[model samples]
Target: MNMQIENNFSYHAPKPGQPEIYTAIREKAKELAYLIDEKAPNSREKSLAMTKLEEAVMWANAAVARN
Candidate 1:
């Protein structure tokens, strides 16, 4: 008899799909802060990050309005 060791890979996510809009917004804001730091002020990437931050804000406001 012969046996071999096996490597492990996983795709099992434990999270549910329920939306936490407020938390989502806060987390996105944190991400934007990181991007701003990485890209710095007045750079092209800064402009892109600013746009994404604006979009996140708009989405958050819409979610709030709906709620």
Candidate 2:
């Protein structure tokens, strides 16, 4: 099997300092969510924006963990 594929598929435990990185990502996402709530009108577009934001956060965390 390819090493990169194996690593990407495997679970990665939080190493030192990773928790803080995750927290920062979450905090920033929360801030963006709040801004969206305050500024963007509630609609399907707004909902999709929120959903994409969530996906972005997940990918960011995965990047941190996988790298």
Which digits, one per residue and each the tens of the lDDT, describe model 2 over residues 1-67? 6999999999999999999999999999999999999999999999999999999999999999999
What lDDT score goes with residue 45 in model 2?
A: 98
- Candidates' C-alpha lDDT: 0.61, 0.98
Task: Judge candidate 2 against the unseen true structure and give its global Cα lDDT, from 0 to 1.
Answer: 0.98
lDDT of 2 at 17: 100
For candidate 1, list the clashing residue pairs, or say none: none
RMSD of each: 12.3, 0.7
Residue pairs in clash, model 2: none
Summarize candidate 1's per-residue lDDT along 7-37 as a digit string, tens digits: 1222222244324655677677888777687
**All candidates' TM-scores?**
0.41, 0.94
After superposing candidate 2, which stretches have Cα over 4 Å from the reference?
A: none
